[model samples]
Target: SQKIEQNSEALNIQEGKTATLTCNYTNYSPAYLQWYRQDPGRGPVFLLLIRENEKEKRKERLKVTFDTTLKQSLFHITASQPADSATYLCALFSGGYQKVTFGIGTKLQVIP
Candidate 1:
C-alpha cells in the first residue's frame, strides 16, 4: 500500500522568509508528485509538479523536489507573505497504477 503524509499539521513562518513543507510516502514511489494550495471553502489549486526523474522543479517563487529513493517530496515558497497562507496538499500519481493518493495537507501560516 502507498500512502502520503505531510510532515506537520501546521507550519508557521515569518513573512519574507522561505517556508518549507514536507510530504513523505511509504511502500511505493509515485511517478509524479503534484503540489496544490487550498484555502478555506475553496478547492485546491495547482501550484507545481515534479516528475520522478526530475530532481527539482521551480515555478515563480515556488519550488518542488521529488526524491524516489526517500519516497518524499518537498515544497518551498520563497519570500513568503501572509497571503500565501493555505493548506498545502501533495498528490501522487503512478505510471502504471490507476489510483491517485493525496496527502492530508499541512496548513501554512505566514506571519508578518
Candidate 2:
C-alpha cells in the first residue's frame, strides 16, 4: 500500500529560525510531488510543484527538494516568522489524470 507521513506533532519554533519538515512515502510510483500551505479551516494553497524529473525547486523564502531514489521530499522555510505558522502538506499525483493524495498536514507554530 502507498502511504505518506509528515510530523503529526505541531512544530514550535522561535521567529527567525529555519523550519524544516519531512515527507516520506512507500509503495508509490508518484508522478509528481506538490507542496501546499493551509491555514485553519482553509483549503490548501499550492506553493510548489515538482515533476518526477526535477530534483529541486524554490521560490522566495521557500525551498523544496525531491529525491525519488529515497522516496522522500524535504521542505524548508527560511527566516521563519510567526506569520509563517501554518500547516504544510506534501502530496503525490498518482493514477491517471494526476489524482492527488495528500499526506496529513504538519502544523507549524512560530513564536515571536
Compare the candidates by TM-score and give the number of the best one. Answer: 2
TM-score for each of the candidates: 0.94, 0.95
Residue-wise lDDT of candidate 2 within 1-112, one digit each (tens)? Answer: 8899999899998999999999999999888899999999899999999888898899999999989999999999999999999999999997764488999989999999
lDDT of each: 0.90, 0.92
What is the C-alpha lDDT profile of model 1 across 1-112, one tens digit per residue?
Answer: 6678896578999999999999999986577889999999999998887989999999999999988998889999999999999999999988665777789999999999
Q: Which stretches of candidate 1 lie over 4 Å from their true place?
A: 95-98
TM-score of 2: 0.95
Prediction 1 TM-score vs. true: 0.94
The per-prediction tally of clashing pairs is 0, 0
Error of 1 at 74 (Å): 0.6
Clashing residue pairs in candidate 1 are: none
Q: How far is candidate 1 from the true structure (C-alpha RMSD, Å)?
A: 1.4
